[model samples]
Target: MYKKILLIMLCFLAAMACSSPSNPDNTNNGDIVNGGGSGNGGGSGNTGDGGSTGDGGNTDIPWTEIAPPLPVLDEEAIKYGIDISQEDSVIKEQIRTKIQQYNKDKGGYKVIFIGTPKSEYTQQSSLAKLVIDIAEELYKYKKYKYRNRY
Candidate 1:
């Protein structure tokens, strides 16, 4: 019985392998024609434009452009003059949470930061100030929404 089952399985595998697509390389179904083009048969070779051609005529599928992702504030350097060594962990956590929430709400595409001139930053700034500055910068791009809390 086991030998018979194995023989049947091998036959099924052979049938499946033979039943595979005639053209495994051509993935674009949009360019496939009904009766095939130039009598070359249905879906022959790549049409040079990364699209494949079918039998009778061109039936290319329409495609749409995807929207670009939003931008998020970067956390690389202390742009706002916040002394990391002197800052509290709780305050840092709060700032990080706010940035994360903003990124989640507005799909982050690339890293962004609010630039501060060296002359303007004379003293060490607070993390809360940094958050506010970042929010204001994002507001210019219509990506930020104030909720009375960061």
Candidate 2:
């Protein structure tokens, strides 16, 4: 009777050990035998919700190439001389023509002419002062005022 009881207990213990859950770390080594496991035959590891994947977030579409910004022209800097002497005569003439045309088109009652001849003012320091003075004088001119009003 003692031998039979011992045998049955040994068999029960063996079955319990075999049926128990496996260690998570052992799943990596393929030692785990998961029955009815989820999804594929692979172990029960979280494989995120297989959504989109690429350069732009979780998107299926490839990243769009961005175009470079258009170059901006500095009107003031282009009008006034940065290094007047360095500018080509053709370009300078074009700028001058454009300024004149702009003024003519404006046809404002008051004109504010700024800047002096680069020739007279060898030094750039007096250029701004000369421009302001000339602008004031032009503003007071009868012809300029008359043409603008008419």
Candidate 3:
């Protein structure tokens, strides 16, 4: 029974693998026309997986233009329009204070703070890496915004 199922799946995959959409140039990976005299086929076969972009097409958030992180709940809620979550409240308070100080020094600017905790980050788990994935996903959906642009 397992052999039969495996065979079926293999066949299905093979069929799918063999099948490809014709490019806008009227070419596909499949077949070639054999005209007359001992003909060898012409035209390049598209061996690519439909030139799959997959998830790589997502635009990165323009972080350089981000507003300062709103230090308090009211500002975070109002500016980001979402409830903020921090795994550690003591650190959250510290982060708020840091943001406030930074904003104060810079004479205040809008910055999007991805609500992930910075304290939890290791060298391998930097905020940039975390923010990038989330920001890309958000940008793909047109949900991420740059305050300066507005």
Q: Per-residue alpha-carbon lDDT of model 1 for 111-145, expressed as tens digits?
A: 23332212232233654466566556556555444
Please, what is the TM-score per model?
0.21, 0.23, 0.21
lDDT of 3 by residue, 1-150 (tens): 999999999999999877855454543333322211122233332322322333222224344444454455665544443223443433344344444454565656333454533334554445444444444554555443464457
| Top candidate, metric lDDT | 1
* Greater-lDDT candidate between 1 and 2: 1
Q: Report the error of model 1 at residue 48, Å.
A: 12
Cα lDDT computed for each candidate against the true fold: 0.47, 0.44, 0.45
- Give candidate 1 misplaced runs (Cα > 4 Å): 34-150
- Evaluate model 3: give its TM-score: 0.21
Ranking by TM-score: 2, 1, 3
Q: What is the lDDT for 31 in model 3?
A: 39
Clash count for candidate 1 is 6
Better of 1 and 2 by TM-score: 2
Candidate 2 runs further than 4 Å off: 1-83, 86-100, 106-125, 142-150
Candidate 2 local distance difference test against the native: 0.44
Residue 27 lDDT in candidate 3? 37
